[model samples]
Target: MSTPTLLTGRDPRSESALLLLSAASGAADAFVFICVGQVFAGVMTGNLVLLGASAAGVGEHGVALRVINALVSYSFGVMCCAWMSERLRWPLPVMLLIEVALLATGAVLWALDLITSDGDRLGLLVLIAVAMGIQGRIRATPTNYFTGTLTSLVSRVTLRSRDQGDSWVAGRLIAVVAGAAVTALSVRFWPGAAAMAAVVPAAGALLVESVPRRTSRG
Candidate 1:
């Protein structure tokens, strides 16, 4: 089988969609880490470090369990998305739909004040992680983890290129940072409502994907 053309294709609409998804990822990460626990919903690499720290007895109560649940659930989501993409030809809109459903469910639970127990919180995190995993696979971009992308883009900016896509990269980085900051503030003041705010970007991504692409005539 051929490798997936995950991020090669470039268009204004696709880039906009990816930027919105990146914002959602940043917001979800901040919300989960602050409101739920000190665990990331999308950044698996950070979770691994946190899991190691928790195993070594370094953090608060239930940190280990939360990290483990996120790891396992994220892996499951990746596998599920891979299977669906391969079998169903990997429709971007369909993948976005799945992500929207999961995120919407988490938002509803948060709004309804249902995440009262440790288990409920864990379930919510897992749901968000799964949604994020599916989204990560769908885009296969560095938007969720912008640190590395930013580093690379900064390096590239020094050497001006014929196609200056670095502007888009910079825009995405700003969006992620802005989204995280906004969501962190929301979670601090309005805990339940923050989840709804996180859902907005995911919905935007879905809407962007649903629009039909225009082809050029030779």
Candidate 2:
């Protein structure tokens, strides 16, 4: 194996924070997909809650099942990303293609009313989940939102730091917030297509820049 560069030397905490940030951003956008587009895009928590209700024989068991499908689909997307990352020297384009296809399909489904009932919604959720999964493994640290997991961001932000530290970490946190905000706006107003489009440029940047630039040390 080739020796990895310093850029790949990601600390555990930083990696975790980035991953969580990605997940949160993705989840925020997914909320729009699930609530407005009749799809479960990310953040399985919603689906899990619905599932618990279903297990209790609640009114809408379909919602729970739909969530489950989304979870599975997201898992598959992650796997695909991992596999592609290993197989192809350049994986970003492959990932972009996958997301674009899924978004397009979702649009068609939404337009056709094929995404009406719980079953239909479940199918769309799965598709979105897969897309998010691919997004999760984009770089050494996740550049795209995963949606399935984001609780880490809250924990990381609340954790006590010994000192003010360099602005690097602070800047990353800000980026996380900004990215999520943009994603939320896109998802809410433009739906999946716009949300994916918003991420595309960032994804391209991440692809071109192998490492995140940091402050020069004295």
Candidate 3:
């Protein structure tokens, strides 16, 4: 018997499925880098402190600016997803494109020293927030770190491994760890460029696997 050849097309259902998987994997990796960077740069905790200080009327304008920027950035990220869902049958490619565009934009901003010395801190925050927001929402399964919080990821892993008793828990936990390792290595070697490099595979995956005819085959 002859082996059947796999034919591909940009079908909406096939495209959507592949895109979702790409988004999930990309988001998983991005989460690791974002979390690590936030922890290292004192961004996440600082946001909380800023919130507290703002509530107490002792907050600096910078805090509020940063907060607003963060909100806007995240909103834009979510909007990217929404835009895809609304305009395209397969929203994954759009999401990947948006992510790549954002990364490129960030690179331009960085090259122009827009986020280095005396840079627009608010703008930078917004960019980071949006990127993180998109990643945080993409997940194959949720256990911990729903928003890139490693602490929660760890705790949930422990709980799920024991309670649900699923065999895949170990593999998922390993993925998280591996992701962290990649982030660390990338950051060490390429610094900010590491983040930009991550978007490549994500985009490629969507482009390669989004064969539209898969949905129609069955």
Comparison by lDDT, 1 against 2, better one: 1
Residue pairs in clash, model 3: 9-212, 10-212, 11-212
lDDT of 2 by residue, 66-137 (tens): 656767887888788777666654444455566556655655666555656756655666666676666556
Error of 1 at 83 (Å): 1.0
lDDT of 1: 0.83
Model 3 segments more than 4 A misplaced: 1-50, 53-64, 87-90, 111-114, 134-177, 213-218
**Best candidate, TM-score-wise?**
1
- Cα deviation in Å at residue 122, candidate 3? 2.9
Give one digit per residue, the lDDT tens place, for model 1 in 1-86: 65443533287787898788889988989889988899999999999999888887899888988988988888887888888887
**What's the C-alpha lDDT at position 19 in model 3?**
37
Worst 10 residues of 1 by lDDT: 1-10
TM-score of each: 0.92, 0.56, 0.53
> Could you tell me which residue pairs clash in candidate 2?
22-145, 74-129
Please write out the lDDT profile of model 3 over residues 1-218, one tens digit for every residue. 33222112134333333333333333334432353222111124455665667777774444555555555666676676555454444344455456556645664564465564323544554554665455433333432232443445567777774433222434434544554555556567756554444445445544654444333455
Best by lDDT: 1
Q: Name the candidate, 1 or 3, with the larger TM-score value.
A: 1
How well does model 3 score by local distance difference test? Answer: 0.45
